[model samples]
Target: MEVLSIVLGGGKGTRLFPLTQSRAKPAVPFGGRFRLVDIPISNCINADFRQIYILTQFNSASLHLHLSQTYVFDSFTRGFVEILAAEQTFEHSGWYEGTADAVRKNFIHFRTQNPKYYIILSGDQLYRMDLKELLSKHRDSGAAITIATTAVSREDASQLGILKANKNNEITEFMEKPGPVKDISDFKIPAELRQDKNGKGDEYLGSMGIYVFNAEAMESCLANELTDFGKEIIPAAINKLKVNAYLFDGYWEDIGTIRSFYEANLDLTTLRPKFDFYDEDAPIYTHMRNLPPSKMNFSNMNQSIAAEGCIITNASITNSIVGVRTIIESGSSLNGVVCMGADYYESEIQKQQNAEARVPNIGIGRGAIVKGAIIDKNACIGEGCRIGVDAIPRVDGNYGHYYIVDGIIVIPKNAVLYPGAVI
Candidate 1:
């Protein structure tokens, strides 16, 4: 079947503030080496779905650069992973108001392909899925739309669209971010569908924000002037249209907030993370940085993942994800932090200029302490500085060069913290 994939590059991502300040949500760096957008696009490539388009509107420069640098298909194969930023044509003049509206504005271009099915995916989610199987299930069920749902704990139901399927696995109803667990009765999964392999069932099916829409049916659905899938379109289309549920059992994470993003990255440093990034058969792909392996000199570290091109010297590190080109100097302590590392290695000439200017290269400095923080790219923490130690809790404040979000100190790109600076 001919399929076209649409990865929705989400809105401003206000919940993830400073990280999304200069880049789109999907373009945010992830796992020290990859971007969040890479997750969905990698899944598409692994599934052999190459005709893909990513939709975006806000802070897309970094995203555009990342897309151009990575994901190049041969010209003759008619495959591409292209970006369609929000544009104002004579027909529409405003920015995308919602997810469905974004697609509706792009329908003119999307309809050109005349694909049999359209697979819609979220750009910020972390998962490994095969759209080929999703399409197969959609074809077998003969449904107008197939919504992918995964069983999630009751605690997570409040943050997701809870789905209810009938005895035949046809979606009977869906409640988007329901208020309380008791209010989920209208959209709770049936007992048979809820039964686990071990015969212990407690979780409810939650929407993964993945959908397979019959192309023509989707066109019609959008023709009604819908603005969102979960909030407006899918919820209204359930009883009026033939909607089915596709069950997916695997690890999935929706990293759409600061706390969630931090926890997800730190989770990777575990013995066996919930989401494995080292699977050889179905590996995640990203832009290759041909830098030397990490070099450490008497650094005391444990339970961490240090990426390539890092230089460590007698630093104390633990339970952290040190990104590429990171420099940790002596007498520093980094615990439970996600150092996003530097964007580029400073050349010898640049280093000389920095030295002449008395500017330190981006890194954690001597005698500094960084705990429970997120150091974004190109940040320079000065000597004897303390961060996240006396940081104001649960506050969002900008300190000229750095930001604090929910008590986590975040150093924006190329920002510097002077020596002896305190949180």
Candidate 2:
């Protein structure tokens, strides 16, 4: 079956704050060296769906650069991947209003391809699943739209889109960010199916924002008045179109906020994280071949994931994830953190402190100490820098150090921290 996979990669990731200030959510570095979009792309590739289109906007340049290098779709076959940006193609010119609107604006592209099915997915998430199986379910159900719903606790439903489905597995109701538990339980469901595996039955089904749509139905709906999916499109189509919900009880997380992103990174260090990054069947892909092998020299590193090409000197990194080509000089200590690549020129051997001194692109001087902090890519830290040790929180520009409300430290990219700055 010919399939066209469209992954949404345009969110600004504002909830991530400083991290997304310069990059899109999908481009945000994750699990040390990998970006968030790697998960979905890997799933598509593994599922044998080579025809892919990444719908990206808002700081898409970085994402485009990474995609160009890692993914190579063959033109010989009908399998080709490309990034679809929002633009005025003799129709409209404006920012993407919402998720559904974004796809609706690009309807021409999909109509032209005329694939049997359209797999819609959000880019900023961590999970491993086979799209082939999901597509099979969509075909067997004969639904106009089949949503990938996960059974999340009622308490966590506030942050997700909640769905109510009938015995036929057809979604009857949908609400986005509807607060309080009562609002979730009050939804009407047959009492017979109420005793599900979790005792709550179908009430636990929460929208993962992953959908498989019949090409014709989706094209017809796009011509309707609906603009947004969760807010307008799906809800409007529920009565008119055949919409079903497929329960996926797997590990899935939306890295939409800083706290969530921090937790997701630390979760990988657990004995068995919900989402396994090292799964052989669906390995997460990223851009890091240029990085050198990780070098540990008399450093006390424990329970830390060091990506390819990191150099650790006399420092001690414990319970952390270090990105590729990161250089930790002597006497530095990092714990329970996520460290991006460090500046190379600011090593202890090359100490240039004068105002006119030339600083390297990515460097962290000797005697620098970072604990429970996230340092973004390509940052330069001067000598005697201390991060995530202050009793008071430090909230500054895109480059300022952020004392995570939960204790994790966050340092944005390309930030130049002066000597003796307590972050």
Candidate 3:
């Protein structure tokens, strides 16, 4: 089947705070070396669906650069991939109002290509799945649209795009981020999940915000007026359309917020993490440079993922993910931290506080210490600096840049931390 994958990469990821202040959420550095969009794009290629297009608007320069290097659409015969930036024209020239609007604007291009199915996806998530199975199910079920549903905790269900389905796995209702008090017990679950077989009360399968739509039906729906798939489209089509629900009981996480993103990264460090990126059959492909192996000299490191080109000296690092070419000096200690490239060493000493620019690589200066924090690219740290160690609040020169959350300090991109500064 000819399938087209549309990854939504427009969200500013405000919940991620300092991380997304400069780049879009999908383009943010993740898991030491990979971007969040790598999860979906790699999944699409692994699933044998080569035709892909990313929809981007907010801070998309980095995302576009990454996509250009990681994905090669020009070398394929029957496959092509590209990014569609939001544009305004005579009839439609404004930025995409919502998810549905983004797709609707791109429908003109998809119509020209003429694909059989459309796979909608979110950029900021981590998972592995054979999308072919979902497409096969959608094709066999004769539904106008098929949604991927998964079970979340009852307490956390309110934070998701919830779905209500009938006994035949047909969706009957759709709710987007409903409050915790909302009751959705009327929906029916699968026999295996049912408290009583052939009973009434359902498990309330929540929408994964991933969908497979019939090209004809999708084009027809897009031709009409709709702004969001969950709020305005799916709910309106629940009674009038044949919407099948495909239950997925595997590892999946929506990294929409910083807390979830941090927890997800930390989860990878477990003895048996819920999500593993080392699957041989479905390996997550990323930019691989022929850099030399990471060198650790007297580096008292334990349980840290040190990427290639990292140079570590007399420092103690535990449960941290260090990016490429990162330099750590003597007497520094890092625990439960994610450190990206930072700029520190300059040709000459910069006297102005703001004159200290971010380094092209990350560095933990001598006698510096950090714990339970995420430090983004090109951050400079002076010796004896301590960060993300306490609940003390600190703000950037501009008030709207960053806010500490739950004691985990978020160091924004290009943020220069002076020597002896403590958090």
RMSD of each: 2.3, 3.3, 4.0
Output the lDDT of residue 45, model 2: 86
Better of 1 and 3 by TM-score: 1
- Model 2 has an lDDT value of 0.77
TM-score of each: 0.94, 0.90, 0.90
lDDT, model 3: 0.78
* Model 3, span 1-423: residue lDDT tens: 478999988566777767887777888887777889888888888888888889988888878887887777545457756889888767796888999999998877787878889999888988888898999999999999999988765555677778777778888778887767877565435547744212323355778889998888787777776898888888877777899999887788889777788888877766777788778999887766566788888989887788777788999999888876677888999999888753233333443433445332246777889988887777767678887765665443333323465446677776667677787
* Candidate 3 Cα errors over 4 Å, as ranges: 73-76, 187-203, 342-362, 390-402
Better of 2 and 3 by lDDT: 3
> What's the distance in Å from true for residue 239, model 2?
0.8
Q: lDDT for every model?
A: 0.87, 0.77, 0.78
Best by lDDT: 1
